[model samples]
Target: MSSLYLLHKPYRMLSQFTDSEGRATLADVIDVPGVYAAGRLDYDSEGLLLLSDDGALIHRIAHPRHKQPKTYWVQLEGQMDESALKALRSGINLKDGPTRPAKARLMTPPALAPREPAIDPKRHPSTCWLELTISEGRNRQVRRMTAHVGFPTLRLIRASIGAWQLGDLQPGEWRRETLHAPRPAKSAKRSGKPTATRPRRHS
Candidate 1:
């Protein structure tokens, strides 16, 4: 059995265990040894984060090729129109490349504790919430996507990743789950002769 940790990572905490700059890190919240973050949340972002001791599980969760859907509750600085939602659903051409189509829609504000340093109302007089889901993992992708469509993200909180939900865990709180490691697919055997099979491409 493998150990998986679901942590409600707090805002302004580094994803890693150590930081030379004396910033808050995972070590401050989680005391688990041997397990590492499967995927990273930006230091300024908050919400669910998965950690595991199994390398295969970590790869499956973190790799973009796996296409695990990550859902976020995004607070935008301004109201986002339908046209912008449609654009996000279509695709956004980013500096790295064109992103895959995503699911975006207006949503009611979530009932959660206020951030330590909350957004200033004066800086953003009008704000709206959006429920956005994307399969691909890119560095700062969610923020960039919204900014590209003219609605800058003021706050980002991941609600779920694949089937894992944030649930009732409060900031800095964590829970552990045990899971069987994923088994690799076996190669097909031919009756007459050994046939060569091309490796599957991740893309």
Candidate 2:
């Protein structure tokens, strides 16, 4: 069986093991050798990051073509309304391209400890906390999307990727898990009526 690791990556830690400047990395938190991060999370972002020794498994998880959904708890600069949610659900055009329509919805702020160093205060007064979920993992995609819609993201915490969730794992903690091939979901039967499938677009 292949080896897998789940790490709650803390802010300011590099995603890779080797850093020339001696910055903190997975090497600092996990002693497990031969495992590599499946995908990268920005050094400023905090949350669950998966690592594996199996190259094929890593490719499957990190490749955008696989379409594995990643969920995040985003704290926005203002109160989110239906229009913003709709915009996210429809699609957001970025410099990279148009992002795939996501499963966007407004959710109550999850119960959790306050951030150590709170997010930067807004220049203009605004509300806090808006949950955003996206299937595509583009480079700083969530931040750009919210900003494009006039709401800059204050903080981003990834809650899950595919079948793995952060759960109660605190920042800087690491755990090992066994990974298996994900089961494919059943597809709906075709009908005479034309069907609408969300187009695959780059973020």
Off by over 4 Å in 1: 181-203
Each model's backbone clash number: 0, 0
Clash-forming residue pairs, model 1: none
How far residue 72's Cα lies from its native spot in candidate 1, in Å, is: 0.8
Candidate 1 structure quality by residue, lDDT tens digits, 20-127: 999999998888789899989999999999998899889988988889999999999889999999999999899999999999999999988789999999988999
**Tens digit of per-residue lDDT, candidate 2, span 1-203:** 46667778888889999999988787777777789999999988888898889999899899989988999888888888789889999998999999999877777777655676776565636656666678888789999999988888877888899878887777777676654443445533331232222221211
Residue 43 of model 1, lDDT score: 96
**TM-score versus the correct structure, for each prediction:** 0.88, 0.83
Return the lDDT, model 1, position 146: 98
Q: What clash count does candidate 2 reach?
A: 0
